[model samples]
Target: MTTNDNPATRSDRNVERAGKLDTATLSDALDKLGINGQCYKVKARSTDFRLAGRAWTIKYGPAANPPGTVGDYIDDVPEGAVIVLDNGGREDATVWGDILTEIAHRRGIAGTVINGICRDVALCLKLGYPIFSRDHWMRTGKDRVQVEATNIPVNIGEARVQPGDILRGDADGVIVIPHEHEDAVLEAAETIHHAEEAIREACRGGMRLDEARKQFKYHQLQTRGK
Candidate 1:
């Protein structure tokens, strides 16, 4: 079968499974699995938005030798991939703005995550497009910072995101699930989610909170190994 028709070749299954989960649960799963995928200091523009998809990584660095462009890579991004930008965590300059937002929105791109900052906050909020970043500012990155690489592994907050890796983000935060360990991570996250639900139900059924937690092994839920 063709690659497009082959479910095994696509990240649809993993993305679908992770789509149901939040960053919190996914973080816990990553922790349990001894994987460092939780991003730090990254907050969503709107807590109402959540995104899960393969990563399209972009790395940025200080401009040099006449400088490079801030954007221009959005056009090459595939549908359903999160635009992961590594701006070296510089909040002083913005790497994304209104024009890119409009284009990404129209193209059906999943979302954008930046280690630095983004401008045009109003447009992103109004369009309901998900943007997770250190902060938003008015200063532009043009001539200040430029694209150093595309589709390469980049650091987002403290998380190392590689191209094609699964990225799931929400109001809580963002987490990276390495492509090779997706199945294990998804299984662990789902297990943790169910266990938490069971504990909640048990408590509502008149069981003491402590007893319910103990019954469901809440402490061990996020603990590494069984």
Candidate 2:
């Protein structure tokens, strides 16, 4: 839940706060805030893997006549940044694989997320590097797909994410918090988390489930704000 002060900013502070929370809580916060950041259909490689960091977005498109490359941008990803690859949800080709995983891990990269698929699943799993994606395959994306842009807005499982946006991922899924709304989202998420904890405490104390929920206003936990 801690972040280095290398380039600390308000968003970074909020990211650290959001990191302590699960995707479910942050997803509820996004709902309450009316932000469409819940990445539907995308999932983590393992439930045990978790990721939280600023996003370094990459957008991909079909290769041209001369063909294009897949993951050459990994060299530019900053330490602790989450590499988000937007491959248009293609499950046939993979933009990530064993080499990228090894290099990213060595560089202290937080994790990676993809709208398409990834190869070398066994290496990522063994290294315990978090990778959230729509699916996984062995096919290379080298000639099939090419990097159109980097540090730009990209789609991940229908969720549009911009560079520097806070990305929180866990067993539930990934959610992006726009830099401008990080403060509000973090605050709202913490409130929801605390309320849920209170409900748990009440239930553990023998209170009826219905009573516990009512006491904490569980029904309105995800209601949008004015």
Candidate 3:
């Protein structure tokens, strides 16, 4: 079939492709990408966050009135794909809980992120599920509700993620890569990482903040191939 003949087919192919990246690789991609909501910062004490092949999403909803069971939307839990949910930034009702977390892992999903809240903390931690949520809550989602139009666009915090957009999380926070800019972002992140590292080294060597900043200007300059 010609490319123009089957649009849906192409999209499915893309989702399949994006789901294959490992948690570490995705994180590195985002660390390199470096664009997320101002509040998209990580707060967990020690998550070691890396969720690879679990792709799912939700829309912004209310805690006073959340959507439904998120399990239904998770059709394909590609090994190492992290489940990315955007609960309209609510910090009360949990869109994901322990049972869902366990299932994702069993299905081979790498990790999960709730732009809202979650429950069953003990179970999640025990299951070794790497989850990053805004806070912890004990509310059930029976009447709440869920929304996942598989491989569709969803927003988390202020970051826009398309169907195949790469999602990554670390102790620092989550960073998303627009599918179109994945490779470019990855390359930029590498350049950024190196720049930050040099600055760190300078600081360790007893350089003051201003001195380190000035020295790193050269490193930053190099990122632009200057």
Candidate 4:
């Protein structure tokens, strides 16, 4: 059967591709393609963490009269999907914490990213469950925010993320790959990765840095196409 016929195979391939790329190289590719996929301000709770997977987006809004749950959606997230939480950049409350982290880790979910804040940092770090967000706080989002929707378009650190979009994060930060541009972005990222590697090798082999960079057209790698 063709790869497209197997969802597992496709997901594996996407994760593998994303695993090989860092946010820096991916950011350059996005720049060249004129796509604003770089998530600003959002950072990993620990530099030791890394994440790569398709997005399972969740958007949050103010809770209703009686308030609502903050993280009942964990059980429904498919394995290998990055849980992208858009809490409207709220810093006062957190949409994630120890319970969610524990469950997500046990379920083999790729990771979690939030535009707002998250609590329970110690648990995530201990479990090596990657968590990226604006920052970590002890406040709970219980009665303050509620899940507005799931598997829907959401914004994280100003970057628009839609369900199934590829997200890759590292010590640098996270970048979203729109599903429609996945192929192009991956291709560009691979090309840039190889070129940069070649430049590095040439420099190590005694070639001048300037000459190597120029030979690889380094300065133009991230330039917007005409």
RMSD, every candidate, angstroms: 3.8, 4.3, 6.7, 4.2
Candidates ranked, most accurate by lDDT first: 4, 1, 2, 3
Please list the residue runs of candidate 2 whose C-alpha ends up more than 4 Å from where it truly belongs after superposition: 1-11
- Return whichever of 3 and 4 wins on lDDT: 4
- Model 2: per-residue Cα lDDT over 77-164, one tens digit each: 7888899999999999999999999999998899999998998999999999999999888999988888888777889988889878
Residue-wise C-alpha lDDT for candidate 4, range 186-221, written one tens digit per residue: 899998999999999999999999999999999988
lDDT of 1 by residue, 1-226 (tens): 0022211114478899999998899999999999999999998999987888888888889998799888887777878889999999998999999999999999888899999999999998999999999999999999999888787778998989888899889999889899999999999999999999998888888999999888888999888887
Model 1 steric clash pairs: none
- Deviation from native of the Cα of residue 72 in model 2, angstroms: 1.2
Q: Could you give me the TM-score of model 1 versus the true structure?
A: 0.94
Instruction: Score each candidate by Cα lDDT.
Output: 0.88, 0.87, 0.57, 0.88
Per candidate, the number of residue pairs that clash is 0, 0, 16, 0
Task: State which candidate, 2 or 4, has the greater lDDT.
Answer: 4
lDDT of 4 at 31: 96
